[model samples]
Structure formats: C-alpha cells, structure tokens
Target chain A: MTDRILAVVTLNMDIVAGGAPIFFARNQEEQVKMARYLARTLDAMVHDLENGVYIIVKH
Target chain B: MEHYLGTIIAGTLAGTVARMVMLRLDYRQYPGYPHGYLSHLSLGFIASALGAVAIPAILKPDYTAVTFLALAASQFREIRGIERKTLEHLDENELVKRGSDYIEGIARTFEARNYLAMACALLTGIAYELGRAPAAIIMALLSIIFVRTFMAGETIGDICEVVPAKLWFKDSILMVENIGFINIGLKEIREKITAEGLAVLITPKNADARATIHDLGQRQAMAHTVTVLLGTKKDVDLPEFTPLARIDPDSGAVGLYAVPVERDIDALILAVKRTPVLESARSRPLKTQAGRMAAR
Candidate 1:
C-alpha cells in the first residue's frame, strides 16, 4: 500500500498547511488526542514531526 | 508381474515415507491442518507410484513409460504456483506480512520435495531389483536421511548472532540499540511501548550474510516469523504496535522491535534465530574478488 498523509494534527496551526485536512489543537494533550483519534479512525500511524505537529500517515 | 511386486512395494513405501518425514508442522504453521496433509500425502503417493513403475517398465523393455516422468515434472510446477497464490492471498490479511521472496522460497521447497520423493522411490526400486528386501530397506533408510539433511536450509542463527537489545526513546523516536525506529507521537503509546516492547540486534557473521539481511523481504520475513511465534500486540487499527526490522547502514546489523503478547525475552530471541534464510534473499558476494576486497 502507498503511504499517504491522511490528516495533520498540530498545536501550532502555522506549521502545517496543505491538501491534507488539518486539525488545530489548543495544546499538546489535545493534539495527541486528536492525532490518536484520526489514526485509529483511518487505520494509520501517528508520526511526530517534533515541532508540535503530528501527521497521521497510512502506511 | 509377480516378481516385480517386491520392488514396486518397497520403492513406493520408501517414497511415501520420505514425503511424510519432510512434511512437518513447525512454527511457520502452513499446512498444519488435516486436509493439507491429506492432499500433500496423496500427491506424494502418485509421485512415488510413477517412480516405482518406471523400473519395472524399463525391465519389460517398455521405453515409452519413461516419458511420463516429463509429465510428472510439469504437474509439480503447478504445485509451486498453487502454493505461491495461496500464500499471497493470506498475506493480505496479515499484520506482519511474509513477503513475496519468503512465499516463493516456500513454494519452491514444496515442489522440490516431490522430486526428492521420486528420487527416493527410484533408488529403492533399484536396490530392491539388485539385492531384494534387505538392500531395499537399507537404501530406503539412507535416502530418507539424505532428503532430510539436503532439504534443510540455513536459519538466521546459522549465519547471524541474535542478541537482546535495549529499547529506549530518543525524544519522540523509538530506538533499538543505536538504530532509530519509528516516531511515537502519543505519550501514552510511547509509555506502553517502552514498558512492553522487546528488541534484538542481528549481526551477520560474514559479508554474504550481510547482503542477505539487507534485503527488505528478508527483514519482513524475520518480522513475520517472530510475530507469528511470539504473538504480536498489534491489531487492525493499532498499526503503532506493528513489528519493524530496520538495518544499521554502517555495521550492516539489523535491529528488530516488537511488542509481543507473551513478553518472554528468551522465546523472542529463539523465534528470531529460527527464522529461515530465504533463498531469493541469499547472496554469495563474498565468493567474488570485488566483494572480498570491499570486505577488507
């Protein structure tokens, strides 16, 4: 299966902007929660970009 | 026809026994069911009958009967295709997949075993014709031993050293020994992995082995085998728990990470060591002059 970014969850909205749907969270806890939800729903993996941004990728 | 009875029976028995010996239900767990055994044993019997009849046919000066061996060979080729297709279908649903290279190796082995059974039958028939029951029995025993030894391929332990490796988190990234694994975004998931995860460092014994483990299919096969034996904590949606084998480019060593349901370190090490070295992944670069010089 081709790896593709399904969604992006970030505390800093300025860091992520693209074709993929992005979710803006107020804090780190909310970002992780949103990323986990999207990953489980999409059957994907949450990879940390290490800049308060987590991209849910289907691998 | 009456005089040939002893030879035919001896040959067919030896061949069937050889097939039975080769058909083992190991950790790989393919053909573990009763139906799988029945079909394979039936095919083995047919192969043996063909081999047994050849001697008597030749003794009767019926040279045309020898040509049927060509027909039997084509049939065995079909067995390889069938095995490949079956494994490929099953791989789709697996959390840890046995890659195409591993599937092809298994299919080739199944085809070769039929030929081995045929050879054992032919040798037994020859022995029976030459020296009756005693010689045939001796020959049968020897042929079975030869097939067992010859068909047994090298395992990971034969070409590499498997050692327990520490799993640690480097910031948000998972690390097995010095090799960086996947990036964990969730703190809870990271904590779970750090608490339950197991890791191993596989160091190749030589240049040839280094090339073998460098193959992506070989690494997948290693992960699949270990997951199958040890039971992975991964699920359909829990892709984070999926086992991974990543190579260390500088040392040519492989670091494998997994969170098993069993959580036994010794069993994990044994499972990794027992994984078969895939034929397609095997490379003998050390045999060449350029490789020899590069190794130094």
Candidate 2:
C-alpha cells in the first residue's frame, strides 16, 4: 500500500491508471468489486463518478 | 346552568370540528390508524374543556387556572417533537425519503393545528357565554369553515405549469424534452426507462416560482407526491430507475422522469399539479423590493 493513486477502473473494463491493467472485470458489478478490492487491499478510496468510472486512490 | 352547558357544547364542537378537518390521512398516511385518531381527538377534547372552563374560572376569581393554558401549550409543543421523531423513524423505510425539512414542516403543522383547535374552542366559548345557544351553534359552524379555509395551502399548479414531455435519450444520456436528466451508459436501463417512463416538464411561472422549485426539498416533495398517486418502478437497489427531478441550467425549468406502476399520464400530470408546496421550500423573492428592482 502506497500513499498515492493506485489505479483507476473505468466501467468499460479498462484500468486506466496503474500499469499492466491490474484488474479485469466483466461488468459494472465486477468492476465495483475489483475497485473495492483494490481500495481495501491498497488502503485507498473509491470515487464513483456515476458515469462509467471509479477512481481509486491510496490513502 | 344553561350558559355553562352552552359554552361546553359550543367549545367542544368547535375544537372537535377543527381537529377533524385538520386530521387527514392522505398520501402521508399520518395518523394512519384509529388509535392515532383517538389520541388527537382526546387531546382536542381536553383543549376544548380547558378553553370552555376559562371564562367560568376567571369569573369565579381563579387567576391560577389560566396557567393550565400555558401547560397545554407546552404539551402541544411535545406533540411537535413526537411528530418529528415518528416521521424520521418512518422515513428510513421510504423509497423516496422525505427530507428533514419536510419532516420539520409537518411536525410544525401538527403543533400549529392543536393551537388552532384551542383558539377555536376559546372563541366559541366566548361567543356562547355572550349570546347563548343559537349564537354558539352558529359560531361553531363558522369556525369550522374558517379553519378549513385557513388550512387550505397552495398547490404546485397554482405556481407552475405541468406539461407532458417526450423522454428520449441522446447519445445514451436521458433527457426530458430538451432538458438533460441523467447520464446512463447502460443500454438496458435506458431502454427500460424509455419503454415505461413518463416525463413531465414543470416550468415556473415567475422568478419567485423558479426560486421555490429550485429548492431540492420541493422537487423531492413533487417526486414523492407523484409516486404516491401513480406509484414508481423504483426498488431498493436500482438508483438509476428512481424518480428524479432535474433542472435545466439554461431555462431553470425542471424535468421529471418516473416509470409509474400505473401508466395513466393524465393522473400523473394532475398529481404533479396538485402537489402541495412544501413550507420549507417557499421563497418569495419577487415580493421583496430588492428582488423586484433586480428583476427590473
């Protein structure tokens, strides 16, 4: 867990921030799950844009 | 003896009538059961009894008895607290939650109603003590009518125009007429909304009306009233499908989207029109000289 933005999970199944596309999710539900997992494990926060993006930031 | 009986009958009748007129079980379903009604009625009775006895007590040189009126005022204030607590508790389960402002307004209304009942009782008692049976009966009827008129608040239609709007998605973003509502990237949710949803555009007649409708609590109240009349397709999980009132930045007109259980568009329109203006959301800027000058 680092004190920086870990990854950004776009609802369209793309990891825009962290390199190597850390989590590949099928749909919105999986996207949310993966985002939460990244947030919890990485000690981060999930910012749901309510459009199609969830930006995860390490706390 | 005759005057005493007349005062008792007149005061009780006036207070009871006022309470009955105010105790309504509409969409809110407040005072929903018989027990609730009984409690209010009993309170009304006690209020009237106190009011009716005031004149006689004063005549008998008992000044301390008037303190009971102050005691009743405190008791009625407690009713406001009870109403707030009850509504707040019930709000947790509401699909479209009534905001705290609305809840506070309702609680205040209940408290005010009890005071109105007390005032009516006191007035009727005075009239009866002065003019006897016939005057007492006449005053009671007049008091009921006056109470009814006073309590009749303004409705949404009085302030704005509610018209049907075409609900369509432009580039997968929901719009009512030209006003933007919600951005939905999901095709299924968009399709479901288009297939079943009803849309209405509420354009405020004037600047004051615009200010009133701009209040989020008022918009929510409009949604709740529409849901109560036409029902909503909303469930717990689906936030996108929930009834929403979005304002157009350019026009200040509100766009409403709701997928009703009953697809009666006319009834939905009527319900929106009939939705009572929430007290918390009322803003009469145009009535002020500064606002009028600014507008000019």
Candidate 3:
C-alpha cells in the first residue's frame, strides 16, 4: 500500500465523500465494516481523522 | 598500617565525592528528596568500599576480595532494571509522558554513573598507593571533571534555530509561516487562538536535525516541555486545542502551535531551546558518507 488518499468520508447520519452521500450505516459497527470494505476494495488503509471523519489511503 | 588507612580513606572519599558531584535535581525529579538521596549515598559508599578494597586485596595476596567487584557489577545491572521499572511506573501519571527511549537512556545513565564512581575510587586507591594522599586527592578531582564532561549531552539549540511565528487563519484553517497547521471552524476557538496562542518555527541546520525534528515523538517531547514550563490551556474534552506540530512538506521546517496559560513567548522560546534532544528520536545521518554529503 502507498500513501495516497482514496477518499475523505464524513459521518452525518451517513457516510459522505466529496459532499456526496456514499453509504448509510445504522451504527458504529456498520460504519467500520463499510470503511474496511472500501479500504480493501480500493487497496487503501482507513484512518480516523476524528470528529466522525475517516480518510482512506494507500501507502 | 598507616599505608592501608591512607588507601581506604582516599578511595572511599573519592567515590563518595564523585557521586555527590553528579547528583542533581533535573526535569525528571526521580531521586527527589531526602529518602532518595539517602539510598543513593549508601549505595555509593558500598561501591566505593568495593573498589577501594580491590587494590589492597591484591597487594595483600587475598584474591577473593576482587570477586566482590564482580558481585557489585551484577548489583549495578539490577539497579538499572530497578530504575527502568520506577520511571515506567511514574510515566503513567505524567501529563507529557517520557517515551521509552528517554527512560531507557536515563536508566543506562544511572547504572553508568555507579560504575564511574567505582572507577574513580579505584583510581584514587592506586594513586594513594603510588604517591600518597596528595596524589589521590588530585586524581579524584581529575576523574570528577572527566565524568562531568563525558555525561553532558546535546540540547536542541545546538542543532536548530527557534523563532516566534504569527498564527494565521485562511478560510477557517490555522496556518503558521504558510504551513497548513490546523482547521479552526469554530469562530470562538479561532478568536481565542488568535488572541493568545503562540507559534514557533523550528528550522533544522542539517539533514540529521531535519530527520530528528520530523520524528513525532521528538515533536511531542518539545510540546510537553513547553506545557510543563508555561502550562497548557487544554482540557480532556478540548482535543482540538491540544498542542500540535506541523512540518512543512517541502522545507522540513517544524511549526509548533500551543495555547498556554502563560502567554509569554520569550519564556516559551527559551524552554524550547533548552529541551534535550530525545535519545529515541535522534538522527545521525553524518555517520554515512552519502548522508554526510547530502547534509553538507
């Protein structure tokens, strides 16, 4: 994995990237799963930027 | 009988004096008060006795006494272990925890100091046996000075320059010297930062210093030192306002942002300059030819 930003997702009742809604997770567990799935699919790693925001990247 | 008395007195006194000379209450107040000094002094005496007796024991044709020096050496190793455990336990309660590297360095220093004391006593004993009491006293002074110089380590000021920089807000983002520091969306928090927060720019003199400053642990140590000297305005809930260091991607200059209770920039600069280069994060690029050329 390389240090390259895949997407910047924010939690606002759902996960949003680039001001567009991507996925709707009911709880923290679902959010984690979605993050992992997106990371694995994009060949990136997920990092929590806190304040309910996560950045997926490949390094 | 007079000769034996001279050796014992000279050796033991030299070791004890060395220990006392080295003892200091620094930033990490480990051996703090009366109790701590009491224990160290007693151990110093024992180490002194062991080293002092070495010369006389060999001269008296009693080889068994020398074996005790080996026993003393083992005990000193255990002392290192004890120091590490003590510091590690105390670190949990510290606001700015000393990293494992710093703790390990301290523990090694404590052990080494005891060994130096033993060596000092031994040297004084030899000098007394060679040229009487005056020679022994002279040797003790020389050894103490040698140890003092050897133990003195480098501070941050030797490797870099620290100067105050104004904090800037561009589109709700905090910037220091054109470096994107942090996002400050809240108007009140941004206002407070603009009013009181202090920013300092640290520029490394060479590649090695740049590598050292880039280490996250080193930056944390610098922030911790500043907080200890000036006091931080951070609370448990106020994570956003926590002291942060941002490095310029191109130039490798570090920018420190902190809102301290004491708003004295001069004191902050002095504190940062005096911060010891953390042993854990120290970079030594000058050791390699390619690295040396790049640094030059």
Question: Given candidate 3, what's the lDDT at residue B183?
Answer: 57
Q: What is the lDDT of residue B124 in candidate 2?
A: 84
Q: Which digits, one per residue and each the tens of the lDDT, describe model 3 over residues A1-59? A: 44666665556644454642355555667666776667657745455655666566654
Predictions in order: lDDT: 0.90, 0.78, 0.78
Writing each residue's lDDT as its tens digit, candidate 2 over A1-59 gives: 44455676775654355462445566888787777666556544555556577666543
Cα lDDT of model 1 by residue, B1-296, tens digit: 78698888999999999999888623263747788788889889889888988899899989999999999999999999998999899999888998899999988988988998998999999999999999999999999999888777889999999999999999989999889988887888899999999999999999999999999999999999889889999998898898999999889999999999999989989998989989999999989999999999
TM-score of chain A of 3: 0.63
The docking quality of candidate 2, as DockQ, is: 0.11
Instruction: Give the residue spans of candidate 1 off by over 4 A.
Output: B25-31
Which docking category, incorrect, acceptable, medium or high, applies to candidate 2? incorrect
RMSD of each: 1.2, 5.3, 7.2
Find the candidate with the highest DockQ and give its number.
1
* Between candidates 1 and 2, the lDDT winner: 1
Q: Could you tell which candidate, 2 or 3, scores higher by DockQ?
A: 2
User: lDDT by residue for model 2 over B1-296, one digit each (tens)?
Assistant: 55677677778778877888778623353536888788877887787777777766676678898899999999999998998998899889888877787788788877877887888888888888888777777878888788788676777899999999999988767889998776654456677888999999999998888888989988888888888778887765455566889898889899888999998789888988888788889898899999788667
Candidate 1 residue B255 Cα shift, in angstroms, is 0.6
List, residue by residue over B1-296, the lDDT tens digit for candidate 3: 66987898899999988887767623242546787677777788888878898999989989987999999999999988998998899888665666676677677777877888899999999999999978998999999898777765666788889999979788667888889976553445678889989999999988989988888878877887788788887654343456788899999899998899999989888878877787778888888999989866
lDDT of 1 by residue, A1-59 (tens): 66899999888877778899999999987888899899999999999998888999998
Off by over 4 Å in 2: A1-15, A18-59, B25-31
Model 3 residue B215 distance off true place after TM-score fit, in angstroms:
3.3
